[model samples]
Target: MCFVLYAGTSMPIPQKEWRNDVPGLSVEALTERESPIAVHFSKPEVRYIGSTSGCGCDFPHVMFQNGDWPWFDDGEHDPEQEASDRYNREALVNLLQATGEQTVELYGVWDGDFMTPPAVREEIALTVIVDPSFRFREQGLYVVRVA
Candidate 1:
């Protein structure tokens, strides 16, 4: 869905509340289902599309990419598993900033099927993730509304 953004207002996704909303996906399912990113590939972080609120096309707005999954290694080999690094908002911002990336794309994956969504400006993603004002509603998720 396409939604226009106004006054730079954006909001972060609340991790805890989102988790409760998805009763079917267990913690393990979420963790195991995380999309893989090639480390040496050297590009902006790609995350799973969990859920989106408001408009999906809004610029500089935060989107629900994934749920709260514990970071761990199952000792199994998926090849890309070791290269795919899922950084928190802070680290992710720094990582993308260093690369000078201008945008990020959110994609959906269900039962091994994949769908590519529109791209959000890299600036907006970084801005909301680090903003402190929206931290009140950020239960592990980072976001903001610029109105």
Candidate 2:
């Protein structure tokens, strides 16, 4: 999972030397440039990539469009979840890699958020695409954070 830039937010600045943990996952932040998804949606900050790396961590986050959320969740309990989450996340990313190189631009992402820790959650509106085999995949989006 990679993150692209957008205007008006306090997301972290990207640093070099970040490792890509997700396979075939490409996401980017658009700073000072127009986005391809702009015509369909409002000004978006992120873009899909054919083959490139973002300055953040790639963790598959199965978020909800149902408005459900993890109440009281944070990094305090992360050590317990890391191993299993990594395994599941890899599976999800692998599935999404089958789509277009630059699928859609996203709304509400801050400057890649590459330097932020995974504990904090940012609200993102993603392009909806349905893959019958994976109903949950209808929503495809990722947050770029520090490893």
Candidate 3:
């Protein structure tokens, strides 16, 4: 899914610069998954899709771009597990800012064969795992949202 930012919006939530601290797959490769990104909505009638495994977490066993970073082994190993958290977190933050969501609570995350209904249609609830401290560290909040 593509996140389009509105014009004249505030800078995205102050997230630390992507440190490339975790090693993982390239961004392009992950986005090609069958069930990449999932958007959720609160109204249920509203039109939105929410879930996990989008943006940089679009692929399995791989993070953003397939590259070497500090957090992971960074030596020819799958970056999905270690990098997905951060990648998806950053993507969610960017999405909220782009859509003008001052404080978005990520509720859920889903990948191929993992999300409910098998395929996300539009307008639904979501629960996501986000780092509450706004830091790239592993400790964070387990957010939930109606999207």
Best by TM-score: 3
Off by over 4 Å in 2: 1-70, 74-80, 104-147
Report lDDT per candidate.
Answer: 0.28, 0.32, 0.30
Clashes of 1: 10
lDDT per residue, candidate 2, 25-115, as tens digits? Answer: 3344443343433333322333433222342223322333354532334536555445444443453344333332233222322233333
* Backbone clashes under 3 angstroms, per model: 10, 4, 28
Give me the candidate number with maximum lDDT.
2
| Of candidates 3 and 1, the better by lDDT | 3
- Candidate 3 matches the true fold with a TM-score of 0.27
RMSD of 2: 14.2
Better of 1 and 3 by TM-score: 3
The regions of model 3 sitting more than 4 angstroms off are 1-79, 103-147
Q: On TM-score, who's better, 2 or 3?
A: 3
